[model samples]
Target chain A: MAGEVKFGILSCANIARTLISAMKLLPEVKIHAIASRSLDKVQSFAAANDVPKETKLYGSYEELLDDDEVDALYVPLPTGLHVEWVLKAAAKKKHILIEKPPAHTVKELDVMLEALQKNGLQYMDGTMWMHHPRTHKMEAVLHDSSTIGRICEVHSTFNYSAEVAYRRKGGLSADVRGNPNLDGLGALGDIGWYCVRGILWAYDYEMPKSVTAHPGASYNEKGVIVSCGATFVWEDGRTATFTTSFNTGHVMKLLVVGVNGSLENDDFVLPARADRAGFKVVSNTSWKDVLGGWNRTEDVQEVTLEIPQEAHMVREFARLVASIRDGSGAVEPRWAEISRKTQVLLDAVKESIENGLKTIDV
Target chain B: MAGEVKFGILSCANIARTLISAMKLLPEVKIHAIASRSLDKVQSFAAANDVPKETKLYGSYEELLDDDEVDALYVPLPTGLHVEWVLKAAAKKKHILIEKPPAHTVKELDVMLEALQKNGLQYMDGTMWMHHPRTHKMEAVLHDSSTIGRICEVHSTFNYSAEVAYRRKGGLSADVRGNPNLDGLGALGDIGWYCVRGILWAYDYEMPKSVTAHPGASYNEKGVIVSCGATFVWEDGRTATFTTSFNTGHVMKLLVVGVNGSLENDDFVLPARADRAGFKVVSNTSWKDVLGGWNRTEDVQEVTLEIPQEAHMVREFARLVASIRDGSGAVEPRWAEISRKTQVLLDAVKESIENGLKTIDV
Candidate 1:
């Protein structure tokens, strides 16, 4: 069904600039089109990101969806507008690579998933870290029982200082994250998405038995959550906790504790040093050495990537699309499974927050 | 009364060996006696650590207490034995420097406190890390609003791989932590004690309004806790979470987040490097640089100590005892306040765990 995978990016959102630029680096994919409601925005974004001259520019999302040249669509629209555009793109029989918080809610995501299934197209959320080589290496260490043993606990936090910019631009009403009509879930959808994904990923996407949101949540004038935290418990006694905020300095951390060892990385969402990514692993530590002295050693392992994580993400998505188009493989269900689990957890946290911090079953 | 502060060792517990050695290094303090029920144990402990020839040796704790030359007693005993011996030491009018878990419960601790008050004795717990100069330096950074701003959240953890040793020594009945009749509160009194103290210390001994213990604690055959975690919330919406265990590899970390910055260290309970102490401070971390680019810089500040932290703890206790004896100053109430708060929080966590993880008010 395919010769080369071509991507059509929907919306000229600022994030789309990075996505398009990363996609341009993948040999398996070509930038096929750029679409927006405003022709000027499409032209400017396409030109600014150095989208290939062969790439078409469409004034409307529907016009790009109707084009036969686009084998897949990358939707980086605002959360509130994702359902409509994602569904339209999926209905056009294009494989979908959608931005995080693929939709505002699980119900909206379900509709998009159904369209992708009915049209026989592939789908994966654009979580760049997942495709990083460092991530894979860390995963190996975590699952290696001899080194890490069974995972006992995990703690992840994703926070950023975004409020100052919102205030400088005008006020809460003018802020996309602060506006209830735009990104209604605010920090929960924006930053908490990564946190929930991290916890689920650590446990191989095993759903938690229950999730209890911690009581206090900071909200904007529009009544959207800007900061929150939660604790989760699995059936077999494993536990995970996470905090997400827009009120603190930027910090992205993930710590996984095991019986024999632990893995920790502060810049889990984004590599700390862009050229190389690293994580610390300390295994089989003892207060006293076998020869009778204290021994404390930790190995900091780094994985250098020729391509940045964002580009690796684009390459992986392109490869998956290529496989499906060439009748080589079926869409990977793991991606959708984790994405749904993340939303389920997010929904439970929101539910717990709304209902006086009750424990909600995942 | 204060020519040189004299200290009596209550028992030849493994920890006493370290405390006595630290005490020997302090010129202002004299090791007056070493005591244990077994004469062989006391003699070997005293000689192995090179107690001075003038230091008295006692075959029983009672003989040590009766020694008129010993001005103070260092009680490094099991949790269940603390209340009985602490009250006994106080009744003899000896100033006290006790190890962690001063008593099994807060009520027991209150009785010991009453004894100290009745006997006009100076008291301090052997929480060595508290006496480290590095701790005070980090405290300054946390309290400095211009740099770190207001403390909003804290995450502290203290865990060690003690299970292998426990098993090697022959299972639950032989393990003090596993025997409910000995260290009754188990991991809560052992590791969780330090985690709770770290959180309380970070907030200047302010008690949390509520504490909810996380479920799924691992226990030995005797049903004593081995691993557990909890979430705490203050009246002002400041939050803290902690996890403590004997099942995992050693990890002692404390991360304090502020509005403008954060202070983090992995060796809060024990310095990672004994010769020097360090903590990372990331202050005034705006999302962008002053010139408008991403800027993330963390400064590692280290404070070198002429004496180890344990020596500093002994020296501090001796100073307090000296002040009491020479009419220089009364005992510092601050140490007792923080110790009591730590016990209260520990009691609350135990209560929550016993009550099936109910949210308990402190």
Candidate 2:
């Protein structure tokens, strides 16, 4: 069941570039094929990467998933098209590691996953920051009673400029970043999802009973927020906040506050090279020594979670496949779980965007 | 008129400790007398800190202001009491340096200043941080044509535990810090005012044409805000935002973004002895330096903002008196200007707070 995972990337959106490069570093994986809306793009990508034999090219995603040899699919389409492709691929029995956010609405997200369950396919959202081992290290500090001493409060902001090259009119009059119908939440949905998802995931998805989202200072009052924030009132009385802006230059960081001290990491995601990212864990105690006891700080034992980038996607897909092959796994895919908890707040964000920061009764 | 300015200590509040300590270092100041609700309190302070030749201990502020020799009075009373005492002292023909948020209501603030003008007394609300010469130095970078560029946006936040403590029953009882009536806008009025005032001041009183604040988020939502944020829009399509929280832990910082570059100072008002407070100005050249020849890296110079402890207050008060004595000097105090602006927005804030973040028609 596991000599190596055969992975096939769908399309050549720039986001897949990092994961495709990451796959090259791992021997247990093979980038067997790629499909784009255009055959020329897929074939060119296959040749440019020196993809191994059996690196077939398909003109359409439907044609690609129909092949019995194709084990899984990665969906990184424009935000609007994601649900269509995800449901279609899931119906074909191909597992998925879809790009964020998998769908725009919670109900739409649910329908996509239910179809997946009806056909039995694996799914994972392209939330890569959590895959980094540092995320868990931060969580351990929060959960570890001995360290960080009773997590008092936490705050994080993931603000990046998505409109640097963004234009209302593209080669075909398409805007993957600007159009709200295509891109759910501008600043909030794109990268802000990470902050929302990160805090929610770190806190074990203790779903907030109520949430208030605000586009108080949004651009043009397009309510297509250049900056929007929300407060999540969790069941356990823990609170987390999310702040993001599509207009601001770039500053994506996370902070975990505790009574004893805090764990602050600005470089939330590690780059493929690892060295370029000063992805450090600034804590009061030596985290490396604490997580990796004596003699374990050596290079091999340093706990660098260099997992397959799409490999998490690939593996999550494979795990879904293996689970369906065995009749069980998580109740729903991690992607679905994440989408459900965050999407309502996201929808409330949509409502907040439209209705001006309302409280969503979750 | 040509000599050092004589001063009177009008109260024995803990907040006044710093300014009182600073008076010892400057020979250009004369501590004329002291007054308090309790004669014992003023007597104890006079003995402990060295009140000049034959200190006058008044049982009431009335007797203290009645003394003809006292040129200026320093009031560090509860936030709510500023208007009352300021009115009384101003009527007695004494220069007024009242504590921050000169009054809870804009109406009261207007009347308090009217009395000052009526009596020909200089007036300013005590905002010790503004007095710090470094604050002016930082402002210089924003104003300086050479270093920082055109100001586009600003993000500021000032929060700590003082909010929650104040909302409890009798929290401010006799303690000014905990009383909402005395505090005016609670967290927003207390700290957010600084960021708002700083930006507006830097922009030549760009009265935000409109403002939209978020619905209050608080554990105890009935009182003032535990956390609140607002977006201030000016007439010329410029914008700024400020957030203040009594619920969150300590962080008093400001970040100003400009067209070509940005400057950030986190510890703007830390005690004068605090390490590394001086502003760090970064230019388009900073990017160049990071790439190897970064823009002229102007290291954070150790700026001795002539306002140490309360020397800014003492010196400023002295300057106001000298102006009165010589028939010429800096007549209008910085506090009066800042207070007028504060009252304007604070008046707007009440509507902003009540109307679920709508901009008041100021």
Candidate 3:
């Protein structure tokens, strides 16, 4: 709080590259330290991302956790290692910015949350888009009873065609996403996390009554899901469906239909343009032409982004960490609560898929 | 066979107003006659559309069917009356252009198909978009294999909010879509018809192996579905989901995600503009930046429409009828088959819904 929120990087994952660059853009945040199992990977990542000379480099995560200069930590490790490192960082009293699929399971997330709360450490996931100015604007519309009305149906998808040269050249079985000892949850954890989060965000994070996985889940040779879909049902009859894949062309879309209006965007997960983000809204529709087709008015609301979404996420997390450090704020349970609901929904979907698309109560 | 194809219209349904106008746009088609049980309704309809004075007007459908000058008939009557009038029109050896949900049930559609085939009369359902030049272009991309690649998933939806002054004043119980006795299938028959057709079109008419209805289907007091969704699964693991509603803001979208690429348009059921229609395609996408987000290269392919899709439909139907009349061609049979397949899928969805979201084979 007195100087800056000094952050420590816990892994050298590919996502860490972008995240570290994003964190560097914030004047109130400093890269205090970086650590990786392989010292060479840590040195290369720090060099490529322009980590300052004063930033400590460590060959082991334990050394980074022991650094008293670090005020916060960012975890971009694989799902399997999240619980171990998250608990260690929490015990060190470092505010945390953890990557998605916050933990391998809801129980693991519970442990991480308990540790953070007991230590009075701030916690937030790396769902960068949630901090974007566009998201707040979209949320205003979705929450306004006059604009989007009551949510009736939501459909979200996040997919990318990963059947490219690298996939073929590397022979996917050994890929981190496909490796059982690494990110064993596969595409469901990697991408479907966004889809499930999108649905929960649209409905104000109210968990669904039940979830049912759809058929056609494709898995790799190592039995990690590469593609999957599911349906969520609420007690009020509102329903949502989402699909995610690593086997199709890149597509990230969210469509929310309501009784009075609707909101939609093709780049819900990642804004197509970094400088600007927008979503289309429609309202007061009726039958206009003789063809019995509809007549609805649409308006594109754009939000100018002075700082990229990832940077905004880092700034938000840093602000929360600074507030807690200065005794001006308590940890916001909202972020971790949202992540847990998303994890619970994902677990239900996976269980339903394992049970052959049977209905599973959330 | 001669100068023009004569079309007799049975019923003064609102859709006939559009169909009659579309037919009038075709040079080789004539609005030869009009009929309704209420003579005043028929007279008003003819006058409102400026029907040629030479065109006959009848107080009853039987009179129009008996007219020897009428070579073909377009039936836009309510679903409850489709079978009765279709059989009578077939008995008159009139080529038929029937409205969608050509029958209340698949069995009813079978009866009408048999009548048309037995009578050796050409038949085509009024699914106007099928004849759109834009459709032909989109089909080329979807089927090219090199462009959209093999279809992996399809998502389609068609919904419109019925909250206008007229609807409020009329209170909607008497509206055909909400009236079980008139259009029993409600949103499923009226809008889901297009969604199912879009999927079938993408797959080149290969019927899905199974369909499972989703929960949250809204129904009217008479037990007519006002909103519904279903998932279609193919033997090859391809999947499709469709949602339709009469209680939401207008939305018409078809998204086709493939292994190599994707094709999508916001106005798949109805082109946003009549003059030109376009769909966005993306392929061979990769990360162009270091944001850890994908960079999908998109191209908007536009197809000019010389005539409205509805007019194109009329012209195509007239051309087929002319060929049959001149002895240069037999009935196409293709249009009828497509309608039947759509009906079969609709029936399966309805059965799945009735059975509590149980999977039903097509």
**Winner by DockQ:** 3
Tell me how candidate 3 scores on lDDT. Answer: 0.86
Candidate 1 chain B, which ten residues in sequence have the lowest lDDT sum?
B286-295
lDDT of 1 by residue, B207-292 (tens): 88999877667777788888888889889778888888877777788988877778888878777666788899876565431111
> Across residues A254-347, which tens digit of lDDT does each residue of candidate 1 receive?
9898888788988787775556878999776766421122345789999987777888888888888888888898888778877888888898
Root-mean-square deviation per candidate:
2.8, 6.7, 1.9
Evaluated on CA atoms against the true complex, candidate 1 attains a DockQ of 0.40
Lowest-scoring 10 consecutive residues by lDDT in candidate 2 chain A? A290-299
Docking class of 3: medium
Number of backbone collisions per candidate, in order? 0, 6, 1
TM-score of 3: 0.96
Quote the lDDT for B199 in model 3. 90
Off by over 4 Å in 1: A47-54, A165-167, A171-173, A289-294, B171-173, B284-294
Ranking by lDDT: 3, 1, 2
- Per-residue lDDT of candidate 3, residues A1-362 (tens digit): 35699999998887888887787788899988999997898888788877789888999999999999899999988888888898888888888898887876798889999999999888899998899999999999998999878898899988876556247557456567777667877889988999999999999998899998877788998888888889899998888999898877777999999987789988887887788878999887666566434566788999988778999999999988888888888888898889899999999999988996888988
| Residue pairs in collision within model 2 | B80-B182, B285-B295, B286-B295, B288-B294, B289-B293, B289-B294
Give lDDT: candidate 1, residue B244. Answer: 87
Full-model lDDT for every candidate: 0.82, 0.62, 0.86
- Report lDDT (Cα) of residue A234, candidate 1: 93
Worst 10 residues of 3 chain A by lDDT: A165-174
**Candidate 2 residues B1-362, lDDT tens each?**
33866677778775555556666557767666677898888878767765555567787888887888888888877767777788778777788777766767778888888888888888877666677767777777878766656665665665555522444444433344444665646666666667677667666666777776644434233365455666666765556666666544344556665544456665453531422246656553321100111123434645653436357667877777778867886567556777888777866766777776565766
Write model 2 residue lDDT over A169-288, tens digit each, in one string.
541114565666777566667777777886776666767776666434364333354666666666555555666655543444565544333455544643323422223322232111
